[model samples]
Target: MTAPASPGGGSVRPEVALAFAVVGYVALAIFGLGMTSLVTNQEVISVPGLGQLPGIVGMTLSTAAFAGGLWAAVRRPHPSFWGVPGAMLGAFLGYLVGIWGAAVIGGTDLAAATAAMGMLATSWFGLVVLAAALVCAWSGIALVRTRAGRPRWPWERDDE
Candidate 1:
């Protein structure tokens, strides 16, 4: 994979590290679950509606993974390094888990379920996340521009 850009290269490495960590975790979970299913000689771990549970942990890891990326991105002079892509991925994972859980609980057809998954995986969530990030970035730029280079602290910033 192409190495992602970074503020100082070190910061970017953390996101890569986090991605590797998540992959390791996913491997462990799959291995453990496979072993469990083997020992039980049943479909214990591969229950039809339970796939999303693993995804919850996956999304949690992804959120942390991309959050680190976001931090690194924000530290850059551009401040948009990997933020949009990272946040978009994080949001997509979150959406995946949410929609999967809903589908499982709602007993939706596989087509519908797959469609929902496709919506997130095919960059719908990314678009939404990009829009949100742009809004925040613009607001931040405006604030820094108008506030004499001093960031307005949340506690001190007015609600208007």
Candidate 2:
């Protein structure tokens, strides 16, 4: 059986959408981590042996990821674009560099490192992913509904 066609007569593949969603969420998390690194003084003491938050690298990577994702969605309007994946990859790397590296370079020990990892993996990542997924799903559904006469735009009344 054939799938339904998009408003543009192209089939909107679920896999593609899922990919975008995942990438977008990861990018969001990276962006968040970058913000923390840039604004907060998470790095108290930096030693030669420790790895500090490379602010420039974190900001650049995070921004690139978000911009790339948006660009992909804008340029291709299709699910299979490299920009989306690039955005995800870049942001994920940035998050690792920002949060994980910061905690490590701040003279953290084995238990602290483990705890930080756990917090980021469970609380931070989980919250960001859940939020992104909800937003994406809602927006996608709204788009589909709008095409199906759901009137997504602002309300307009008839002139008297």
| Each prediction's whole-model lDDT (CA) | 0.45, 0.45
Model 1 over residues 51-83: C-alpha lDDT tens digits? 555345434544454445444444454443335
- Index of the highest-TM-score prediction: 2
Q: Extract clashing residue pairs from model 2.
A: none
Q: At residue 74, give the lDDT of candidate 2.
A: 32
Q: What is the TM-score of each candidate against the true structure?
A: 0.34, 0.36
lDDT over C-alpha atoms for residue 4 of model 1: 41
Q: Deviation in angstroms for 85 in model 1?
A: 2.3
Quality of model 2 by C-alpha lDDT? 0.45
